[model samples]
Target: MPTSNEAVKLQHDAGAAPTAAEAVRAIDGIAPTTGTARQVADGVWWIRLPVAAGPGHVNVYALQDRDGIVLVDTGTNAPQTLQALTEALCILEPNHGTIRRVVVTHHHPDHIGLAGWFAERGAEIVATRGTLAVAHRMLHDKTLSRTPEEIDFAVLAGMKDLELAAFIRRPKRRYADGVAMLPNATSVIADGETLQIGKRCWTAIVGNGHAVDHLTLCSNDGLAITGDQILPGMSTNLNVPADQPDLDPISAWRDTCRRIGEHIDERSVCLPGHHTPFTGIAIRSRQMAASQEAVVSRLLEHLQRPRTAIDCLAAIYRRTLSLAERAFLFPEAVGYMNHLANRGEIVGLRRGKTMVWQKQRRPRGDTIRREASPAISRPYNFSSEVDESR
Candidate 1:
């Protein structure tokens, strides 16, 4: 149910436990705009910037404070993108000079694209160490080649020859190309740290699974600037790339969602990176968690017999895959498999150039569940329809 942006995304967001209606309204009470600023809160303005990747747009928020304008997230680094931001700010504050602070929710290309530009102009960019570290590392490093690694992973995951050839022959330096320019964060904001942007005090709530460390800032009063951590209706991607093949974004994402739902006040209005900025975060959070768990259950059912990630794609996703869709689906396929493997719910066996996953085949009728820390542990109930004869 992720829209085009999240649907095409191989990622998605959630908030604390709130009641959600299918038809949620935008806080600004305006339709989507390419490059215009509309006031969404008492002192915060919402600006949408079109990104080339994923959903083609990112929502940039500008908060007015006594010192200057504080931005929750900045769009990419293109001339037009920068110009749009300039126009919005000029109109918001005719005498604006400096962007007092730019708090990045994560280190993605679209989000961090303009941070460097702002930072160079005396803006103090604030983000977690993970965001700051990754931005600096990916920005300066050039050889962004992952062909060899990806080819291996694809083959092992059961990609078809035509698809494999297309995937490998295509561009490989995409980790950088996915966004504009990644700007490094100057101030490393830690989780639970209270930052005084203007008159309001915002606490940093660091999350993960989507990005290693996603930052969601919650105002002391009741508002939140949640980057991609929690979109109103979409779920963030938790795909595990080959570099960190064993990592479990699923568990990490679950833990983060539950924590936010428990901590953030029920009445908070969160400003997300995409989709309409709306309330009902608490229900949306539950929706996301349930959606992810549903995927896990589907994967389990598909594993009645030994299967590879590619085999379970049809079960996890309801749509057909185009080459572009593969970019999102492949990682998602592997992520679910890896999550099962991590929890000992399944095991993998190598076959020639590929690997196949099979149910771990637990003892008699006992319902199996993932055993993790209190932050992320969840039970997985198997359907009675599953054939144990395999």
Candidate 2:
């Protein structure tokens, strides 16, 4: 895609109507249709898989390697998604090489679902320790019952007894169901660690908020396999965990966006988890931060009177939510409320079992201070297998 930098250069080069490619690149970037592969960068291909759930599609990257191809962020293990992925891989097989390493961006099923499938085909699984820990746990556990902590959180989010029960009784989509096989071993990568894939050396950068220890790798030339961290035209979900009610994901997300933005410039073409490949990393980072600030402002207005996270949902989203949607989005509402509470823009009080948030009045000339990023140590030792397992 032509970045803001490229557009500037284009103006000085010639004065003519833009080509179809240039025009699309100048606009909203390029979105590769599902079941297809497009070369976003030299030796780097963007493969999009069709998803029946959220976003309608998920993007995976295939980086050319010395021995084979290094696949980043596998799509879901659903039959159609797998078929689409297989077809895309086959189309690139003649030039790109075989699968050498499957690098998972996070533990989300849509992103990591096909890791086991690739691993079975002699591809080494690679991901952050935190991601591996959660992936392994979910892949091994088959139960669908809600935990005591989850029930408590449902109540805190204003979920009624009947509603909570119905949510629990609904059919579950387990993590194991998304993977073709169990991930027996993984090569863990740390933040700032450099990995050699083909002629490129990518530095692993950790991103939070969307997922615990989300892995993002930026090459020396500025091409980034960003996963879900820095998507174009959409805000990454910042969900608060039930166990960690006080965790401030917004601060972490904002810091992560800034941190990732520092590595790339306006010319870097980032391969994201969803949507399309685009440039202007720093600009996109600022946009994401601004988007969150706008959400916070709207939320503060919604808190004119005391309101529960559930009560403010309509005001914040302005849409009717299904039971499934509520189950998926309730934690994010808590996250926004917690972010406001942490900023001192709002105060939360316990009303029996539920928590109601009220806007806080600050003195004249007083400014709200930004919260420091949460310090959560990653589970580095979660992997019993070593990197040499490959």
Candidate 3:
């Protein structure tokens, strides 16, 4: 059985392949308790912060600068996170002074949540332009309503009638709830830009498919502060964009994995946004890309009959999804559907207010051979289980 954190990551990827045993080796066997700091490298400390829900903890790094510290990826804006961060900072203050700068890896609520709080304390918030724009919008926007595009996308995912009405009426989760505040001014960093954080000069590598322009810092000494783009033990989620419903993020994600793999070697120690520090980054990145390919391949086979994205869940998932899992995994299913459609392997047919997908018929001379998947029997007629009408 996987641990809670590993289970959460599996759910995030909608049941992607398990982490390869030899791909990554954890540097630290166990993580430090909340409010405590663990030194991972010279002038670099790992601080785990408590998360109210999901994964349970997020890892932030403190780099010792000449005058103070440069913190990367602040935890959520919750009280427990703030308390833990305060204690961790106090623990590092004797050697690192105070936090002079904060480098946001992404605009996710968990990573950038406390950025505003730090900015208020005179810490320079540095992030990519895409990240800053999205973070600012999510932090400040309070109004939540399903746009016409969103509703249409939901319908295409097989939601309609009472179910669609209920979904529309459901209170949208607010990103502001996790974030403290947004700073009026932010220092924007670009991809491939060399940053002088502390003593080591690091290059910023921007990746997509997880978040818009997610930043990962790589030092010449082979230490990488990889955010969610390249997690060690499990695959990250590639959610379909809400605004661009037809956009395919899986392709971007695969390209990113390849690029990161080429950039970082096996000897590099990677400090991810979650999970313990690990090595064999090249292998892990390849594993992630291959795992996603397997998912897409499996999804292709499951498209033998006309199905909705919601109905297709029965085909890909290893087990039944919980309520919370369903809410998050819905977008992932849509992502897979879009990927297939974009590849010309499937076509969506409008069925009333809903859209169903069927495998695209290819020419006899232009057939695409599919890899053989393990034989597993699952009942296709899972109307009771999917319950799209609910």
Candidate 4:
């Protein structure tokens, strides 16, 4: 774990470096899929299928047992994703008759989109209490469909109209806690709980940050099913949802990464929700930690000049965005900014409809530059020219 002193020192040192895009590209390069798999380890198999929106593909893992198979993180509920999962399951374990349970790592569409589909198939959907609570709240009230509720929620959080409207376009669904609606969810697994499937027993590790109650499963066979908790290529989004105003997701994510590093060894095969299964859990954890630290450092630089969350996002992404993309970017941008503010590296001041940020103090002799004015100011309009560059 990085101490506050160490974090501050690193933050200051990092500000003297190049832009975030340069640092990220130098570290992880471009995000690429490592392709899906059949069986990664003993009794553990993964199916990487594509989704219609955002981040393209998601991986679903199947733990084979004598009775049936237990699935971790079903892909989106789309027809193509469903068909691919069915085929993949049949190929992995043809003798298996039914999916006994579906463990949702979090409530993202790529992760839980097929929860209802699995429920229809009589597979019990399992998730952490926090995840389930948020899922239910978002789903029951049709929050995604209502524009006014979105604007109200965003404005309450000090967001602009364009930011709130971007969020309202996405479809949302709900799931309650305590295993009532999902079939065969005999019990809710808390942090550090052990679950038995067929002949194997896996330990559930509850983590927050990326998702409210992200669950990463570690089996005795040296395999850890890390849904979106840890990805091979890209950094997972640590979003500040409209529903949860007080949660500090960036801190939660960093701590969760450290906790995951402590629980799993370096050699344990990581079955992530998006990328290919690979070893080096510790390496990935450290990289994620550094990446987050780097984000904070970049935000600190942005705070040198007073800027809103949208301004910070545009500066960092450096590309035109869609409504859905802006919805994803705004919270993430604000989350990291908020993390820095909590660490006393940045300060926030509300100005009418927007919240502006500025650095607490100058770091050493680093000189800050003003952000260039955007050529196009239209909200949620990305031209084909910009799309080609992306």
Comparing candidate 3 with candidate 4, which one achieves the higher TM-score? 3
Ranking by lDDT: 3, 2, 1, 4
TM-score for all models, in order of appearance: 0.84, 0.85, 0.87, 0.75
Q: List, residue by residue over 1-390, the lDDT tens digit for candidate 2.
A: 101122222222231112323321322356666667888777888888876666677888888999889999888888999999988888888776889899989988889888898888888999999898878887887877777787788788788777788876876667687766646677999988989988899999986777889999999998888887876656677788888876677767766766676688768877778777777665565555555555666787889899888777766555666676677778878988877776667888988888888888888436464453355332121112211111
Which candidate would rank higher by lDDT, 2 or 4? 2
Q: After superposition, how far is residue 174 of candidate 1 from its true place, in Å?
A: 4.4
Clashing pairs in 3: none
lDDT of residue 52 for candidate 2: 65
TM-score of 2: 0.85
- 2 or 3: which has the higher TM-score? 3
lDDT of 1 by residue, 78-194 (tens): 677777788777776665445788888887877888887777777887889888777777776676454577778788888877887777667644445444453443678898888
Q: By lDDT, who's the top model here? A: 3
Candidate 1 regions exceeding 4 Å error are 1-5, 8-19, 22-29, 95-97, 144-147, 173-185, 363-390
Give the candidates in order of TM-score, highest first. Answer: 3, 2, 1, 4
Using alpha carbons, what is the TM-score of model 1?
Answer: 0.84
Deviation from native of the Cα of residue 373 in model 1, angstroms:
12
All candidates' lDDT scores?
Answer: 0.70, 0.73, 0.75, 0.62
Clashes of each: 14, 1, 0, 1
lDDT per residue for candidate 4 within 187-228, as digits (tens), equals: 467988988876778888887777777889887767788887
